[model samples]
Target: MNQNVATSAPFLVFTDLDGSLMEHDSYSMEAAKPALAELARRGVTPIFASSKTAVEIIAVQRASAITAPFICENGAAVYDSSGKILTAFGLPRASWLDAVHQLRERLSLRFTGFSDWPAERIAELTGLSEGDAGRARSREFTEPMIWQDTQANFQLFQSEIQKLSLTTLEGGRFISIQSQFDKGYAMKWWQARHNQPRPFLVALGDGPNDVSLLAAADAAVVIKSGKSDQLDPQGPATVIRTSIPGPAGWNDGIRQILNLLDSQQLLIY
Candidate 1:
């Protein structure tokens, strides 16, 4: 939280990280620095909502010099700026991990999850540094995994997991196993805390997992991605798509939306 940023502003930007605010491969936010600076200048709080774990999200916030709170593990939990759990939507990671392990053994599933891999292997798979990979593995809830089985087997796995009261979400690079809650549930929970002047929520994301997040927002920005299954969030009254991909697209989308809101006098600061 930059001291210059005004938390009193009636606006909030909830953004995804991996392929939305950061680049897909390089994992850099260099291109979005200008937009971030503008956000700070405008006194708007940017809350991160991602599949990353608490430690990983905290590390990203530290790197970016941001102290705002975050929603982690694909809406499994919300943590304050200091990494304290504000609210949790899903069961503990161990519960989900145990169920996944049991299903894998019973169904002979062929997926490699974070709990089954070493930090080095996770680093190799995700292009993250070994240190960051370790942070990613420090999950309090949910398990992100790469599916390595046939489509039919994957469907069987999903069916079995659903029977056990678990759900799966396909992210930018991995499919995560967790409880039924999605990003929208977490966002609304966070929003409910503000009663004086409820914030105007804006969400930006670029994956199937982000669909709930986008739909939860009063405004949504769908950042372009190189992947064929580009997201089309349907609920928001204002949905803007960027032409470019990665952080550049993130930057453009933010600027465009802010300008649009300002022109329409929708921002109440």
Candidate 2:
């Protein structure tokens, strides 16, 4: 909670948005902006790794004033500081479509493809709320399709590679499949390329989509409120499991990590 310690710790902070940074339904990042910006001013780079599309992530980045590389669509792609595509991991488009079609044919569920369709068409077919659909279209970059509830919707979306996909059902909140992309793979890719002397990698997330990145990090913080724990079988790192929830919990979690770094003399706060 003390602002002094945060500015002294130099570390690569990768965070997930939906439940980690923003509230689940309200989607507010206002509370943490100052701390995040202060961290950046002090030589810490806050990298955003999330299931959101590149466009959506970029908007969040701009809002947060973060110019760091971003992992989008669950690590399907890692965009560099220049915003150029550095590395992309996913199946080919044709193969991805084939898999979707085949899965759609075999199962009993609704289907939608991220194909280059007009936003109107996407909304008509996938039945995404007009507001959410509009946001997807307004973005310069975004995941292609929006599918509804059902195993068919889940499988059809996950059957492909290359681009990341998000599946939202009627009674359920959205769930992002690792498939050909995600946070874990993105963070690992970044670590390999930069090869910086990492003080101690830490990842904080709130959902199954964050599991991969959490597993990859030296330390992980899982926000407990939603179904994230049920979605994650492995759970968070044993080192610091603060009982605080939401943004308060996240801030506390980071403080805990900084405490460890300070004790080790790796940081000064």
Off by more than 4 A, model 1: 4-7, 265-269
**Which candidate gets the maximum TM-score versus the true structure?**
1
Q: Across residues 154-233, which tens digit of lDDT does each residue of candidate 2 receive?
A: 65445442243523212114332224455687787777664345445678877666777787877777766555544442
TM-score of structure candidate 1: 0.94
Q: Which candidate is the best by lDDT?
A: 1
TM per candidate: 0.94, 0.71
Residue pairs with backbone overlap in model 1? 1-67
Worst 10 residues of 2 by lDDT: 168-177
Q: Scored by CA lDDT, what does every candidate get?
A: 0.86, 0.59
Full-model lDDT, candidate 2: 0.59
- Give the Å error, residue 23, model 2: 1.9
